[model samples]
Target: MQPAAPESAAPAAFSYTAFALSLIAGLALGIALGRLLGPLPGGEAEPWQLRAEDRNHYMLAIALEYHESGDAARALDKLIALKPAGDPLVALAEGACALGSGGYLADASGIAALRSAVQLYQDFGREGCAERLLPEAAPAALPAEPPPPAADARAQPTPLPSKTPPPASAQTAQTARLAPTPLPRRFREHSLRSFCDIARPAIIEVRTVDYLGRGVPGQRIRVRWGESEDIFLTGIKREYGDNYGDFQMEEGVEYAVDMPGAAEPLATALSTGSCYSDNRRGLKSWRVSFVEV
Candidate 1:
């Protein structure tokens, strides 16, 4: 009653719940419209919107396709569409270098094919550090020796010779056969040379051959750089000759090449720091040959 408490009016409480509901509804509506309308005009397509790593993979796919189809114009157009900063060939080389350095050459499927395609492009006047990343092409399988001419099924055994030999020359030949003849050494470093060639940079070319000087396929060549080592077999690249297996070198690092049973490395202290060719620089290469002793 006390004059009706002066009817002191209280301000209405703010409706936080209503504000939050409105915000959520508006966001959902925007999303729905965006989905219906798709990407805005002038926006990049799905391929172009890929991240750097994904983009590289896309380029690799294009390369592989090109390799299979042998369509240069199509491949070039596809690569140029990627919006690479400079020459598309450079991008191809960079991708190849990345894959090689990342150990893709070790065992990944299709990696060799990708590298081969990249190398094809690299040969078109764009060079990168990918030359050495390429693995030797697999050697053609050797034909098995025909089973010793099947022994004649109907032939008779020959008569035994009389055991009355007393010749001095025969005796000397027998003694020589009994005496030990030194076995030829299995392997030796034949030659080593360092030079610069723009076409092939930072390459450590290895060739393994037999006593007859024919390429010895399946021979293993080891390359050592600091604490790391890589073993590659010859005959992988038939085009390079069956005896050939090459390794790529990194800048500022020393490398050594050796065979399994060799007394020492075919080449040591090999580096690419000083070798230069033409107006370009830094593609020092070495050639090492190994032969059966």
Candidate 2:
């Protein structure tokens, strides 16, 4: 029977299109499974990746620890690990201000300590508004010494000591007279100038200094526009003078600048109107200064 027609031996041809479709389907299934499983192990967020508020808290904790241990290097290392966008010192100081402004320092000795630690850094040129938000802590009251044990009534009383006024001298009088009470220091506007430049955009630049004209770091500056307000501190940008701080201004908007306890705003309303420089029109810029009076 013709060898049963050789059993019709013939292999089925492979479909390249079917292979490609199967490959694509497998890849998609793998991706879906990965999504359902979430991130792989050890994928925890880094300390630098913490949320902004959490990062502030982290900075405060570091400052408090630094206060207790006085380990500035360790504290600095820890702060650097946070990967702050600005100076670590400034970040620390801002954290202190945030804590104080947020009412987180009420009866919180730890937070107060953190603020004190930040102030110590301020002396080194690190600047922030912490001092305005949180004043220095008052000294603790000294304990009263116990009165000498009363002499026993039975013991004979000693003769009363003579009370004689010593001869008055210039030194004695000078010592006795209380030094004239010093007047409280206040800051007054030193200078205010406005200009424009094509290269530099509009800004409110503020500088604070002592009576001696020495740049004072860590001074707080407040800027209000519309209903919004912002505070900044000097010395945050060391490249600029330690007393230098700046705020960018939006075109056609007015802003008020002030400091704590000032009689009034430094600039009741500083308008960012147009100005000409180098024969080219541009937004206006301001340079204002304050000095201790």
lDDT of each: 0.67, 0.70
| Candidate 1 C-alpha lDDT tens digits along 18-83 | 989999999999999988787644454666556667777788888776655556678788878887
Model 1 worst lDDT run, 10 consecutive residues? 138-147
Candidate of highest lDDT: 2
**Residue 234, candidate 2: alpha-carbon lDDT:** 77
At residue 19, what lDDT does model 2 achieve? 94
RMSD of 1: 23.2
Write model 2 residue lDDT over 69-127, tens digit each, in one string: 55667888998999976667777776776766777656445445555555445534554
Best by TM-score: 2
- Full-model lDDT, candidate 2: 0.70
Looking at model 1, residue 63 earns an lDDT score of 72
The local lDDT score (0 to 100) that residue 266 gets in candidate 2 is 73
In terms of lDDT, model 1 sits at: 0.67
